[model samples]
Target chain A: MAQWALAVDLGGTKIEAALVDAAGAVLPGSRFRLPTGGGSSSAELEAGARAVIGAAYAALPPGESLLGVGIGSAGPIDVHRGLVSPLNLPAWRDFPLRALAEEVVPATPVVLRIDGEAIALAEQWVGAARGSDNLLGMVVSTGIGGGLILGGRALAGPTGNAGHIGHVEVGGMNVPCLCGGTGCVEAVASGPATTAWARAQGWAGSTGEDLAASYAAGDAIARAAVQRSGTAVGQAIASATALLDLELVAIGGGFSRVSPDLFGFIREAIARRSPFPFVAKVRVVPSGLSDEGPLIGAAALIHRADYRSEV
Target chain B: MAQWALAVDLGGTKIEAALVDAAGAVLPGSRFRLPTGGGSSSAELEAGARAVIGAAYAALPPGESLLGVGIGSAGPIDVHRGLVSPLNLPAWRDFPLRALAEEVVPATPVVLRIDGEAIALAEQWVGAARGSDNLLGMVVSTGIGGGLILGGRALAGPTGNAGHIGHVEVGGMNVPCLCGGTGCVEAVASGPATTAWARAQGWAGSTGEDLAASYAAGDAIARAAVQRSGTAVGQAIASATALLDLELVAIGGGFSRVSPDLFGFIREAIARRSPFPFVAKVRVVPSGLSDEGPLIGAAALIHRADYRSEV
Candidate 1:
């Protein structure tokens, strides 16, 4: 029987639970999802998480002993304390998630990591960054977040916020970020933020999907808004590539799919703006793992023991 | 007899030669200098470097075997080509510096590195970053250049230009960088750039020394310009700290001494603008090696085996 572990990816709107093997391959029919509400209390969220975990466990192969649990959550997480205070989930501030999960499954070790980091680790382990010594995994979804894998190891600083790239200042008009900084990449280029900015500019689009459709229909304002987001993201990446000398950037998440033209524009922007030749060559590509990036990466956090040296 | 290595730090205006021991300490009277001129051809610069190296060698204690030679040059240097194309020394582009130096001191192994990396390595080996795993060493001289040490290794990427922080965009009013980037930290905050910007703003300051005197004498424009440089530098550092999870930034070079109040303002700016709590706590302190940081760090490239892993 194949050994298995429970992988959970927590986001603002939903929680995804899966039974994954060491290779990050999910068991067939072992995936489940649960919705999260804004007004939901911590207890409600915990109950929802338990139900999803129970569903995934029931589908696990017979006689296959559970190894451990790996969790990827929206962060400002304390890896040592297993606590998280994600801004999107204000009610879950300093939430002791690891302990709460342990309450349901006694004596089973649980590892908690940032969602962005999980994506990066997953990429490094079995996806785009398979042989790469240096990699950055970017998630340009509801918000712009990222994770870093350097020297073939996952980078989680003392507070587990090492790969928080969303707030890095990119050149733009000052827009207030949820993290309190102004003109951050997330504020300027995130899906919700870009759509909101486009709507405020009189574009009749309320969602990213609508905006992309309008862009495909040659709506001038919608095209301009996508270009603006792409430009800010490119400019910010040019700076990061220069600073870290990153080998590759794997871009995953929903908004990045708004258009292939966006990534092409990003490459051109970096080429034009980056002062150094080597930095411009830093590849920015799509993550090979799409919906499964976070869950796979969370499992990779435990399976890739070579990554421990970086911590 | 003490084992000594010849350390050469090649800057735009001057080349410093020192007899550095394994511990990166300089011997008395073993320090020598050579002036640089724009009109000087590459051959003349080579002759000048040989003379300085000869002088330092002569001053060293007799009967000591020289282990090797370590050179740190102001960069955009191609380590593979052993060539430099420093903006400050345009005439010396692609100059075969290693071969020329090898001719002067035949058969001794020569190691070449960027001055920024040299300083960072030296700092990591025996200075402020001795116990730290990740640090950024910044030189606030005529130009703002820096080196990065991540995961206990100096980071020199494919082209030996990993930590080019000067080009990292951190918001400066429209000014072109020598590196062809706009709004770069170098364009806004380098010593000469700051003084030039201040003078262009109608402040009666022709030099950093004059600006310091003017700031001390209660000149609002001078103080504002200085403060702006610090703020830009601090904000850039905050972003870099967030991206890399740096532990400390050891600041050196001539302009860093403009005012003690400048550093305090920088701290305040970082604390105010940093989106994450951990990024705000990154320390910005003066260089422990002072004027010798470049030479010592350059020598460290040869002495420290781990430091060579970057190459």
Candidate 2:
């Protein structure tokens, strides 16, 4: 019998699969990746899920026993029903993800959750927030997403969308977000949004990587854009800290590498604006897992069985 | 071999003590109360704590074993050091609460937490948030205080103050709060603050209860005052729902009962202002454990063994 579970992390840009052992270690030779795009239809999305699972299954020894499947999707998931309808993934409207996985790997239970919560769980179990009871994990990539682990448990509210930090309004920007909120963190500071904001401010940079390069080169517009994103993020974290009394905020994603100076600026902003000293102490740090975060976090679900999972 | 624990709920106006069991049910004839005031010095506060604890102890059988002690104090407490220097407790700075409790009951272990977190814990253990993975417990009394439980654990951040929701900035409020923040929900909506705001607005009410009575008697000014507080609270909750992805906000304390119309107004305001369907689904409800919330929640600290106890 295989002493491992299957973990799938579905992102807006990629799909990752891993066979995670009972100890949360990703088994060697069980990790693979696939591309994801905005143009995919519902059928395409289902097929993508099947292809990844099938490939992972095939790599395993024939007739090996398997644990349940844990799938972490982008956002707006219904954990109870294993439904997903992420705003960025138009094809996944109310998609029965667990049922589809059940069809692919018959009789193995499928546990569905938002990617943000999965990352938080990962952090709580084995990453930056290890040994901490209260943690907030944020993904500041093409868009901002977050999850909370309070009192040693992942907080999945009704519909499994608690910790949707992107939609919480920050001041001074009325830019509309895909989540239908105005003045949200994503509206002002997601990778595309930050780049767009910089472009509108007459910056010549076209990409986040280019923006980062220019920022390292001390370009004025690029620095301002990065600072702006950091400011919004810092303000949001301050508010979150005040509201939730979080111990640390573990931030990850490609866009978060804009500059170390940006994090300094965020700390300054939070100190100046926040009222509560406890909230002010909430550290905003980088994710420890880096590229391996999703896989490790996916594995965390099976490893931390009492925290989540059915049967 | 007895399972009873001594539970203490310390507030600005009163200190209550009760003997509770493993299930958090208060023992008959074991609950007692005492008055507290602002001028209380460290010695006086210690005396007060001793008095209440003494009363509960005296009420119990002399041979009964007291398992432990749990203290739910008003902020701000240093849970790590077991010290309390609450804003409401003026003469209290760096007071060793657990040490003092040890002086009272040397052999018993002591657990210290903010009253807000205790309330949240109470709800999580036996009240409204019993089965919820993500819960926010709010006390809408003299000031708005809160505690959070995400994924079945208390969100006690660094310093053991995880759910300090009062300082969360509510947009458009120009009011200043004791926490030094302007536009805070507490500044605009807390009991004394709301009453003061109403009085400043030409309403002759002397108290929140009086204001509630006036509103019940159809006084326009009183009704408007209540509505204003409700609106601010609703807006804050809406923001919290967006940020935290919370399922239910269980509100308690005297101010919450200002009107039956309060939660209804809050729900309406949230629905009107929420940018997403999920945010609108967030429930605003009264706490199931009202007067007994703190004591019950203090015992939940033992019952919810998933959370590590400082005691």
Candidate 3:
């Protein structure tokens, strides 16, 4: 009988659940999602989690045994406590996410991991970072986040917050970030941050899409904003590569799609800014997974031996 | 029959070899050393290595069996090719340190790693970070170097160069480093760098020790220089902690001892500069090992299963 795992992906805006097989494929019609915005209360989040988990479990095949449930939540999560304290969701502070998932799938193992780590696992398992023993997977949407796979294993630190790359300071820029830090890559490189910078620079763009269109139109200000964002990201990557000796970085999310040249900009900045030959040699690539990347990575927590959460 | 491993530690100024037991203790009277500085040629290094290795082996007890050889050398080393290109020793560029060691102890399993990594392993095994599974070991000497033990394993990346912390930029400084990068921690916090800064600031200090003495006597410029170096180290540590979610950082080397309050300065800087709670919470401590740290760490490459070199 084929083995299956219940995968849950909880983000600031939504919560998703799916039944995935050993091969990392989400079962057809097993995926479900529920809205979970900043206004969501603890009760509402718990209800929403249960509803999607129920829908996913209902679609599980009859003969396949459910090995476990894997959850990837927006961090910072306390894997030891099975709780989540995601930055964006104010109402769900210290919510017992793992316990709630366990209630839905009683007597089965439940694993909780940060969303970035899940994405890295998916990419390393079946996407762009396949065959790489040391890789970094990053998302550059409304917020920037990343995960690491070093020595062919996920690096979940003492608090399960190892790959919090967005918070690392970006040199020369003293801009305050939402994480209470200054000069963070997320403050300069995230889609919203880039769009905000473009707006402040007298470019008449209010959204990332508008900025993308402006960039495509060859507007100098839009180009400058995008380059600045890419430079910040590249500088952060250079530092990470210098520290981790990473082989590749796979970037995904909305803002990274603003321009194909964005990657070129990032690469150029890394080469120019990095002092070590090893760091300069690290490759930057786009994530090969689709929208199901999160769910697939969540499932990886149970399916892949190396990525299993310590708790 | 006591099992022992031959440990070799190669630095900018000297090469040392010794026999180490499974308990991380170096055998008395087995340790030998040879001078190796910038003026030393590849042939000299080879001869020195053989001499040390032969002396160490000659002192091996009657019933003890040599398990293997573990060598930690000044990097950046090409572990894949068993070669070393130490920045200080230009004559040893691409020099096959591993091959030379293997010649001294043929048919034994040979392991190679950066000297910083060796220190990390030693600390993790029996030094300041004994109980901690995730820690960083740093050397704040003439040049800054570091190593990491993450997830209960020594993190030697694809090239055995995972923890090259010195090269990471210290945001505000634009000083160029010897490694072709600007604003590196080594450029600002190294002993030579701090002394140079002190000299440029009209301080008559000729060495780190002189600066320490001046600071002890309440010299303002000397205090400023020491504080600046400590602050730079702390800022770099903050960034590294932010990225790695490290539990502890054990600092060693001559310059770190320049001031009793150096660690306090580093800690205060980290707390002040870091925006994230986790990064600020990481502990910075002194290395627990004596001068035998490098040799113990080199031996750990063979003694500790987690630190075994992939090559």
Candidate 4:
């Protein structure tokens, strides 16, 4: 009988679920999602969670054995408390996400973790950093976030927020974040932040895609904005590499693709630490997974269970 | 009848050795040392290693069995290859320190790791961060270095250099390091560096002790220098906490005690990251061990062997 796990992903924008097999493949037609936002009510969220989880589990093959249910949610998540409080979803503060998953799937074990950690596991399992034991998997979309795999195991930390790289202040950056901190990589390098910086510099682009188009058309300000974000990201990566002696960093999301030279700029920042070979040797590359990354990562919470440490 | 391991610590200016029992205690009268500065010839270093090991071994009780030999040396060390090349020790370039230890203590297994890592293990084993599995042990002296224990195990990244926090640049700092990196914690906060900055600022302090005296006397320049270094160290620690989610950081060395309020300054900088609870909550305390920290740390290479991951 084929073995599978019901994978659920909760984010600021939506709740998604899918049936993932032992080999990390998502069962065809098994994926489901429901739109959600900061404005969504608790009753609506509970209904959406039920719908997606049930739909995905219902699609499991007749003879397939369900290993467990794994959930990956946006932070700040307390894996120890099995709660989630996504920054963009003000309606779900410390929501009992794990309990909800368990209520829907009685008699089955449920595992919960931060989405960034799930992504890192997924990347190591079958994405850009395939087979690499030590890597940082990052998302650079509306906000920047990351997860770590060290010595082939996930580092969940005390509260399951080990890889909150977006909040890490980048050296020399002065941008302020809504998180009330200055110089956070998210404040300087996230898609909206990068776009805003470019607009402030008179580029007039209002979105990541618009900025990408402008950059492709050789708009100097767009190029400079992308360069600035990439540089900041590289600097953060370098600092992280120095402290952790990481082997590689796999970055994904909307802004990472804004300019083909984005990675080059990040590399340039890392190069500044050439005197420290360990930091200089760390590799940075685009994330290998597609938009399905979040779901796949959620699935990895179960598929890569051996790599996880208890909270 | 007590089990004991022979411990060795090699540095730029000296080589030391002792016998540490399974209980983590250094057997009285078992410790010995020899001076071997940068100008020491290859013959002098080899003789020093042999003499220290032989003396420590001779002090072993008549009936006690030996566990093994453990060496902690100044890095960049290639633990996998048993090589060491301390930057200040011009005579040893990738010197085979491990082999020499093994040759001196012929029948026992030998383990080698960077000194910083050894200190972290010792701290967790019997020092300030005792039993707190996830922590960083740092030295703030003529130079700055550190080691990490994550999930109750020492994290020796590939190449045995996981916790090199000294080079992690502080946000907004512009100090240049000899390592070719700017704003490195060591460049801005090491004992000599802090003193040098004070001198550059027209303070007459010539040593850490001199600066400490001035700080006691209310000298404004000395106060500023200590504050600057403490803030830089704190910023670096905050960055490290965000990346690693560490629970505690136990610091030691001459400069760490330069002023009673030095810790207050470090805490003040960390407080700037108050928005980040995980980083802000991390505790920073003085080292629980004394000048014997290095020797005990070297012993922990054997005493706390289980905490280490193979390179």
Candidate 5:
């Protein structure tokens, strides 16, 4: 019988649960998903969570041991209290997601790891950052999020916001973030932000997909917008590297794929900091995992218990 | 018998060694120091290390066993390889201070930690941030340097430069750092930097002490200079807090004492980021340990073995 962990990944738009075996694979037919959006009612949210979680438990193979349940959510989560108040889901203020998980899977240990940080754990366990324990994993889609694995351990910090890098302000970039900080990496680099920048620069693009098309066709505004976003990201990464001394950073997400040149621009910006080898030595690469990265990482939180809530 | 570890702190201007008991006290009369300048020849530097190490060994109490040695030096030190190449010490590039200590105290393990990061260990163990396991310790004198105590342990990243915040560029700061990074916290906030800016603004102050005196006497330029440095320091701290989720920050070094208002300016800048509570909640205070913090922290690397060289 294969040892396993039930992994739940809760995002702004959806909730997903799956049984992931020790090898970081999602057991076939074990995955379940449900939409739980920003406008979700309290009752609707719980119902959705129950549906996905119930399916995950039902998929458990009989006689096979279940290690624990790991839930990865959007953060500033109160890991100590097992509560989550993901920014995009304002209706769920300090919602007791852990308690809900416990109710669904009684007597099993339920651990909460932030979704962003879980990605780093996944990358470190089996993806791009597999061989390097000190890594930062990033997602640059509708909004930017990141996770850190330092000293071979995934960090959740006191508030499970250990690797909350999106809101960190970037130098010389003055865009206002909804987080109320000006020039945050998310404000300058996320898909919407990049698209908006291109539109403002007189490009005809209305979305990331349109921007990617224009970028491939060599639209000047589109190319400039991508460079601007990637450069800001590189700047933020340089600051983070200065503080954490990370060995590798893996970038993933929809907007990051808008152009391969996005990475080139990032490298150019980092190379400017070559005066500091620690910053320059940081290897920035595209994340090697598929979309299932977060789920696989959530399971790793339990399966790789030695590095657990350092998660 | 009191258990003790030898601690050596190597800086640009001096080398100091002492025996510190497990209780975090430097054994009285066990401390020794010698001048070691940036221009010192390799032979003179080795002689100074020998002198300090020999005195520390001689001061060790009879019949008491030695716990090992910890060396703290200005970074970027290679903790794993036990080599250091501090910027100011031009002649001692990649100096084998760890091996030198081992030769002086044979059969004893010697661990190397960057001096800036050592300060954080000292703060966590016995200073203002003593009870907070997650903290950033800063020195704001001739130069600004910092260390991180994250999740209750000091961090020495791959290169032993984990908490090297001095050279991280600040968002609005445009000052040029000697390290080739623009607007680095050190270039914008260090004592010498502050004094230079004040002088450029026609303030007659030529040193940090003069600026402090001028500010006390109600000089506008001096006040602005102080605010400039403090605000920059606060900005860097906010960025660091965002990345590390620190609980407290203990600050020392000569320039920090220029005015009580310095802390107020720092608080004011940090308050601007109140939109992010994690960044806003970092408590900045004076160092609780006296000037002996670095040495005590070095000894801590061995005495507090659980937290050791996590230093």
Candidate 6:
């Protein structure tokens, strides 16, 4: 019998689920998603989660044995308590996500991990970080998040938030972050953050898309904003690499695509700031997986032994 | 026959070797040391290392079988090439310390690791971090250095320099560090750095010991300097905990003992800076091991299975 893992990804704006095989390919017609947002109530979230999970399970192919279920959710997750208190979902404080998912498929094991970790696992499993034993995978959209793969295994810290790179302070910055920290990388490097910085500098950009277009047209303010964001990210990465001795970083999300030379800017910042040869040697590359990365990484929680946590 | 490991610790001013049992205890009367300073040439270092290794071997108790040899050296070491280019030891650049030690005891595996990693392994094995799976051990003496024990194993990155936390920049500081990095923790928190900062501020202290006395006497400049160092350390620890989700930090070395309230200052800074609960909850404790920590940790590379690397 073919083995399949039911992978669920819960984000601020949506809930998605899909069935993935051992080869990392999603099963035909097994993917589903439902809307979830800031205004979503607990009951609404619960219903949305159930609908997505059930829709994906119903599409499971015949003669296939369900291996397990893996869930990747926006964090501040409590892997110890199998609970999630995502910053974006105030109505679902301490939500028992694992138990709720288990109730949908009784007698099957359910694993929950932070979304950033799931993305890193996906990249390591079948994406750009395929051969690297130590890597950092980052998403730089509306919010910045990251995950670490160290010693060829996912580094799920005590609370399953080991790779919270976005929250680490970048030297010389005093910007306040939504995460209640000052000088956070996300405060300076996220898509919205860059756009706002550009707008504040007299640029007429109101969105990341506008900023990207202006940057392509060689607008000075747009270029400065993009460079500032890239520099912040690079500084943060340098500190992480210095502490963890990472080999590479895989970057994705909308802001990272603002300019093709964004990677070059990040690389230059790292070289200029990183003192050690080992830290400066870390390579920054584009994420290998596409939009399906989160689901695949969630599936990896069951499909790949390296991504599994004892908790 | 009882199993024993020959442990060697090479520092800026001296090289020491000792025999350790599987239980992590150093054998009495089996330890020896030799001086090697900046003026010492590679030939002198080789001769000093040979003498220490020979003395430790000769003192090996009867009926004890040598398992292997473990060596811990100052950064930045190249574990891949078994060479050491210690910043403090200018005379030995890319010195093949591992091969030199191996030649002393033919056919026995000689494992080399950064001194900071050896200290961390020692702490995790039998010191303050016992039973904690993820911890950081740091030395805050003449120059700051650190090591990480993650998932109950030593995290020796590709270059054996994963835990070089001293070089990581502390946000908002622009102090020039000896490691060629700006705003590094060591630049602001190391014993010499703090002393220098205090002196520049009109304090009469010329050394860490003098600063400590002045702090004990309630000198304002001295207190500020100590607090500054502790704050920098705490901020750096917050960043490390945020990135790695560490459980505890064991601090040792001379500067950390400058003031008893240094720990309190560090805790306060972490609480003030760490945006996440997991990072703020990390315990800061005194190192369990004494001066022998480096030697015990060096032995751990051979005595403890978890600290052993494939390379």
Q: In DockQ terms, which candidate is top?
A: 4
Q: lDDT of candidate 6?
A: 0.87
- lDDT (C-alpha) at residue A266 in model 4: 91
lDDT, each prediction = 0.80, 0.78, 0.87, 0.86, 0.85, 0.87
Worst 10 residues of 6 chain A by lDDT: A174-183
User: Model 2 over residues A156-177: C-alpha lDDT tens digits?
Assistant: 7766777877766554455665
Which candidate tops lDDT? 6
Q: Is the docking of candidate 5 incorrect, acceptable, medium or high quality?
A: medium
Model 1 is docked with a DockQ of 0.47
Q: For candidate 5, give the DockQ.
A: 0.53
Instruction: Tell me the docking grade of candidate 1.
Output: acceptable
If both were scored by DockQ, which would come out higher, candidate 1 or candidate 4?
4
- TM for every model, in the order presented, reads 0.92, 0.83, 0.95, 0.96, 0.95, 0.96
**Over 4 Å off, model 5:** none
Per-prediction backbone clash count: 0, 7, 0, 0, 2, 0
Please state what fraction of the native interface contacts candidate 2 reproduces: 0.46
Per-model B-chain TM-score: 0.93, 0.93, 0.97, 0.98, 0.97, 0.97
In model 3, residue pairs whose N, Cα or C atoms come closer than 3 Å (at least 3 residues apart or on different chains), thus clashing, are: none
Stretches of model 3 off by over 4 angstroms after superposition? A62-64, A178-180, A273-275, A309-311, B180-182, B273-275, B306-311
**Can you give the DockQ of every candidate in the order shown?**
0.47, 0.32, 0.48, 0.57, 0.53, 0.55
Which residue pairs does candidate 1 place in steric collision? none
> Model 2: per-residue lDDT, tens digit, B100-151?
7777877778888888878888887778877876778999998898987655
User: Could you tell me the C-alpha RMSD of candidate 2 in Å?
Assistant: 4.3
Docking class of 4: medium
Question: Sorted on DockQ, highest at the top, how do the candidates line up?
Answer: 4, 6, 5, 3, 1, 2
Q: Give the Å shift of residue B171 in candidate 6.
A: 1.6
